[model samples]
Target: MRTTMKLDGADLLDLARGAAFLGTGGGGDPYVGRLMVQQCLDDGLTVEVIDPLDVPDDALVIPTAMMGAPTVLVEKIPSGEEAIASLRALEAHFGRRAFATMPIEIGGINSTIPLVVGARLGLPIVDADGMGRAFPELQMETFGVYGISGSPLCVTNEYGDSALIHGRDNKMMEWLARGAAIRMGGCAYIAEYGMSGADMKRTSIRNTLTLAMRIGRCLREAKDRHENPFDALLRLLPDTPYSYGRIIFKGKIVDMRRETRAGFSVGRARIEGLEGWDGLMEIEIQNENLIARLDGQVRAIVPDLICIMDSETAEPITTEQLRFGQRVTVLSVAVPAIMRSPEALDVFGPKGFGLTEPFTPIESIV
Candidate 1:
């Protein structure tokens, strides 16, 4: 079993970049998180990533990330210590310090923000995350699906404002925290879904931190070797739980509608096919890409990844960054077997988002 890994130089950046890809058009941009981690390194900080199995069963592990509209995040950048403050608030409420910090979801900034917390606090970042991909709401995560409570969640914004929220359920927690975020200038950092190491082993997606890094490494190295980056991605994913990676569509954004509403960025995008591809593909969003349809037939849906990237550079575009006339390729990957369970689907699948479409795997639908 893997014990630990040290992130420095390109490792941190690759992890951030790959997270941007896995984010599936949510989790906000990794660019800011990458810069923060790089700054930590510049200040002679070390980011130690520990395997979840190494965590003691009794230890408290808190997953930390920024929560709110990704569109709002672009304008309201974090002050870097907001998450740490959130964690401290949790610690104060629990009357015990945290054993480690981890990402609640695998997305651009959320994927790397915990590393920033870890380096600043001198704690290890667990190589695990609550969700394999980003989701719109806090309740839509494996942590909640598998019975981890999302409160006593601590929400904090820059300028030292903070609130510790408790809820009867994860959905209630999301509602309360999201309202807090919107009131706090539209974005806030959070530390929530606190659980024991045992809870992590049972519910969290393991090794995703390293997987995100490896994904970035593959794309970067492939480019250096003058190979197709997308081909490198397809080759790399099958070996992991998120498998069956394929190009679902090639197109240019013909039209897009996006807005920051109710503390979430909600919208849809239409991509007209190019490169011998025909028809149009539509991707609906609520912070993250939820369902993608090609010519009105579902090719991918929630719980599976529906990623849009720069066709030439393979750079993942968040919902906020999406625009008209950009050449993009849609890559769909199957989620881990755990995320597809009927119980898990109830919280994060199509029905979870109020859609009538039955949950279907990318391989089956495509």
Candidate 2:
């Protein structure tokens, strides 16, 4: 049976909160995306999400996302004109009207940006996304890993200018798009990796949008009930394929070094143990938290998740917003089984980020 969920302004808040958590301290803040989708509601546009399984096998499905610094994505909100323009450019080039739009990742603004595009174009947003969470590079996606090409990519900026790129390979597409994003003032909206509904079911991560909303709702409800939000998370994630999650380290951020390089917020953060949690914890960031080390031993690495959240409220903190002296709890979650496959790991595992260590699940280490 095919089911659909109609989204409203309030749903976006919950979705944003969940997306932030999944982002693992990157994906840009969801504030801008929330407002953008809210405006779509305010305009009386219908925003609907359909199950990936429900999409007809022959239906044309397009994925949309932002490219460039996660910091830039959060700060610079643009009108819907560019997003719509990008998708239109894709339609023109491919000569196929899209049956739906989906997020390439379920983190920060990218998750909700697709809703704005879908609402404007009268296309339902698919409940699935490529990366269950956020990753730095364009090619670090299940779609790309499984052999879907991101060519015929359309990128648009706030200036109403757009570029259409057809790369020989997805990695090359990523390189070209990264350069384009840099030239488009550090960020731009993209509609790429156009595929059939069947391709989506086979290659994309499933149901992350709804999962994000459920996570957001869990936090909000826990707070309203005066419950431990972290406890709420542990209870909620297991029901889904994420399988296991826990607070790995709790402390205050004592040191952070971040810089904008190659269109990414690249840095490392050191958190001094506090609240009786012994040893120091550190996280390597490139748009997203890639790895965490506790007292020199690898605790969690990429292909898993290393999320930093406010200890008291469980509110996720993005990398660019990290500051010294902020009390935090680092939550590590095991990624889906599909993402841990050898093929998937080769593209986004520890080595993909230049770390020589092998990929290890948080479930085993923490």
Candidate 3:
């Protein structure tokens, strides 16, 4: 089915909140993304979302995304043309006529990026994404798990520079993409991993886009009803357990350290906890929080959701968007069962982040 909607500022804010929730504490900041999409809406652009099933079985679907450091993506706003350039480059490289475009990940800015690309390219946005929750590496996609190749991937810098990256494997594609992104000043526009709807059915996480919308809807309703939004979200995903933790840290951000290294938002935060707990807590982030330490001793890490939410309102905060002096809550929710598999560990475990010991799921730790 094809549907068109007029997404205004309120819609964008709600969608951003919902996208953050579905992001599972990983998709980059939704703030900039909401602003960009709102700009498109202001330009009288109507974003159309199409069900993947609406496309022909053999329909060629290309996923478009922003690659590099999320921190840079905010300062260096996309020129819009680069998103199209990446899409066009992929079309030319494949030597096949293009089909539809889809969001690669469901995060803040990326949630609506494909809509910008689709509006510009005159393509429809696929009502789904590859990963229901964001991961650090491009190869961590369920699309890759189902045997899809990352390249020949198309990338474009805001300066009109464009290139095609080919590699022996997905890992190589991820490495080269990150390197290129760093060279492009910590962020690059990417249109990659073209595949069919049938393949998507096999490889992609189903209904993630719809889920994002629902997640967004839930938050909006929760807020309007003056109910506990976070609790409502926990109830929505019955399959995922809540790993509870105190508001160990709540204070002004004293310091923030971030770098776009190895194609990830690697950073650390120093926050002083208030109320009962006092002192500083250190958070280590790479796309997502992998470790939380209190005065140099480990507190919470992977396998549990080491979530940072707006302390006042309980909205989720992505690693890249974190700033100093922002009051936030650090909650450790249990990891979903799907992420506990040995394969999942290899992709996002403690060892994956170069921690010395193997991962002990956050559920076990908490």
Candidate 4:
């Protein structure tokens, strides 16, 4: 089915919450994205979401995102032109106008940056993305997994400087882009994985924007009705690509360490279990929560989503936002089918992140 949806102010607010949740402790903060979208809405611009099926097979589609440490994004806010600049640079290199823009990942700011660019350029945004959840590097995208080359990648910083990287594969592109971001100030806007609409329809994670909105709306409504937000989330899980999820732990952060290094927010958090529970739960993170261990036993690992939320409000806490003594609840959701395949696993599995344990599906673990 082909459908076109419009996001208004209220919808964007819900989307911000859901996108942040889906970020799984990465993708940068959705708060900044929400502000950007709100400003666009206030300026009378419209954001249109198009189903991938609606795009012409021959049409050019570009995925745009912010690359580098999420913490850096908080201080060095984008000038809004960076994303557009990257897209324009890519167009110049490819010699074709982009038919539309889409998110590289439907998590946090990356999810909304494309919408901002699409509105500015008066183009539709395909309701799909490269990664259903956020990943640390460019090569971790499903597009890369499916053999899409990330050549002619474009990167731009807030100061209006832009660079185009070519003659390299996706993995090399990540390294080059990361170094550029570090040199430019630790964060930059990137546009890569350009492809034909047909290729995107085949490789992209479909309808994730709608999924994030649905999740945000569910949590909001649950709070308004004084219902348990956790139960609301669980009830809605079956309808999304991630059909299984559970609160793996509830505790207060007792120890945490984080630093922005090599364009990534790398850190670990230790939580003291509460409510009659004993021992501690530790989470390893690199931009996103990669793994969780309960008293040294693997409970959840990357390729699956390990999410942390405020214990009271159910709002997601990004890796950079984790603070000592803050009560939190950890949740794990099964990743989309496309991301769980053996091919996809090689790019984001436990071993890929230097963990010794073999990747186990969250469903199998819990």
Candidate 5:
């Protein structure tokens, strides 16, 4: 059965927190998503979350997501109408009405994007997502494992211009779509991976929205109880183990050296670890962190979730926000088994990020 609820400002905050926990350190800013969703909610849009079984077997289900660098996405905000335009274009391309719209990932800016589009289209939003955790590429989805392609993608810019692209494969789809996003000034709304509800249920992580809500609730509850929020998260997701690490350092942000070449946020953060640690730790970023080195020793790297969160509240910090001397706790979570397969490595391993050496499972390192 389908369900509907209206989210106020407080509800949106809870949703953002929950989505961030599910993001697993790769989705873009949840703050921007929060603002967009809040705007829709203020306009009195009712968010309808529908179960996967509620959709018919033959129903057309299209998953939508933001394409391009997260830093650029925040700067070049959606033209408000582009989200709806992307959906409308897909509807036009398929020559049929879409039964539902949904998120490709269940967190960050994506968690609320589908809702905005759904509110505008008067359509129901699916309660699931292709990837239970956030991934870096369009093709790195469970849908891909089930042989779904992201081609026939429709990208719409803020100026009402739309382009329908056909890639020989999902890689081509990402390439062509990324190029177009650069031309569109670094961000464009895209609707891709059209499939049936049956196919979606088989490929997607079921009840991911519910999972996000649960994660958010746990974080809030942990804070109230003065318990470890990270521990609470681990308890919530027993399938994924959380890496044990300390509040290695904390300091004010002094400088930010960044570049947006190759469509990735490539930068080095220089933070002077405070208290017992009295030196600099060099942090790296490429969409997400690939390495963290302290005083010339490699501390953490890929396949591990090495993320920087606020020292007090434990909120995640994206690559773009890694500034010098920032008061932050560098935390690492053991990678989930889902991302450890050779095939999965071939798609998103250290080599995929241009690292020649093979990835060492995070558990082996810390």
Candidate 6:
């Protein structure tokens, strides 16, 4: 049976933490999103999450998210209405009121921003998302992989500026949105990849929101009980599509190279293995952790998730936050089944990121 859940302030906090871990070192930071949701809850707003199956088959579903460099989002916070404005613009263009809202990704700020928009618009949020984890490009979403067009996208900035693009395909949508975001001062709110409820149920990574919440709750409860939070996280993985998790490396950040370029935080990071392991690891970043190498061998790659967390606290560290000399544990999780399909891989696989090495599942590697 399908079930629904209401999100309170406490739930938002847990959601943020879980989303950060799932972000795989991208999706922007969740701090701004948490603050926004907290303010909404303080005002007594009700944010309800509905199972994708519970949505009417013909209902119009709009997926909303932030587009641009993660670092830029930190410096320029939203006006709280950018998403709403984009949604309204889409509603006008489609000539139909949205029946519900869903996150484009269930990671970092993108996860919580949808909740805020749902609360403000009095709309139910689908308990699913486009990317099971965070990805950098618009065409990387499951919606795009499943043949949903991202055209007629509406983008808005904090200063009340908005742009609507009618693209031929999802790739075109990404190019247009990237250029538009750069023009709008590096960050913008986007409402795109609109689909019907039936299509959403078929294309979305189901129950990702609940998965994130459970991960967060497990970590929090583990800490409360003075148990290992990483162990708690591993225990919960079997219940989700991400059935595997492993700490592939433990090290201290020795170097990081990152810059906000062309609307993306792009660079690499190097870490030296600590505590008697004289190995080194390297990570490629483009808004999110894309690839990781240990001792000159590829350990993880994009479309799969590579997360770096505080070794002791288990808190996720974003790509932009990687600092010199901070102890960290790098973990990798297998992408969901839907993302492993031949077509899905074509869009998010190693080649999609311009890597010569072929895509390999994290499970097979670890």
Model 4 off-target regions past 4 Å? Answer: none
Model 3 earns a TM-score of 0.85
Model 3: ten consecutive residues of lowest lDDT: 239-248
Which regions of candidate 2 deviate over 4 angstroms?
none
In model 1, which runs have C-alpha deviations exceeding 4 angstroms? Answer: none
Least accurate 10 contiguous residues by lDDT in model 5: 239-248
| Each model's total of backbone clashes | 0, 0, 4, 0, 3, 0
Best candidate (score: lDDT): 1
Give candidate 1's whole-model lDDT: 0.91
lDDT-based ranking = 1, 4, 6, 2, 3, 5
Clashing pairs in 2: none
What's the TM-score of every candidate structure? 0.98, 0.98, 0.85, 0.98, 0.86, 0.98
lDDT of 5 by residue, 80-141 (tens): 57867877788888899899998998657888788778877778888888766566667767
Report the lDDT of model 5 for residue 288. Answer: 59
- The residue-by-residue lDDT of candidate 2 on 32-66, one tens digit each, is 88998999898999999999999999999988888
Using lDDT as the yardstick, the better of models 5 and 6 is 6
lDDT per residue for candidate 6 within 139-227, as digits (tens), equals 99999999999988999998889999987888998999999999999989999988899999999999888888888888899999999
Candidate 6 shows a clash count of 0
Compose the digit string of candidate 3's lDDT tens values, residues 41-91: 788777767777677779889998888777667688885778789988888
- Candidate 6 stretches with Cα past 4 Å from truth are none
Give all candidate RMSDs, comma-separated. Answer: 1.0, 1.0, 3.3, 1.0, 3.2, 1.0
Candidate 3 to native Cα RMSD, angstroms:
3.3
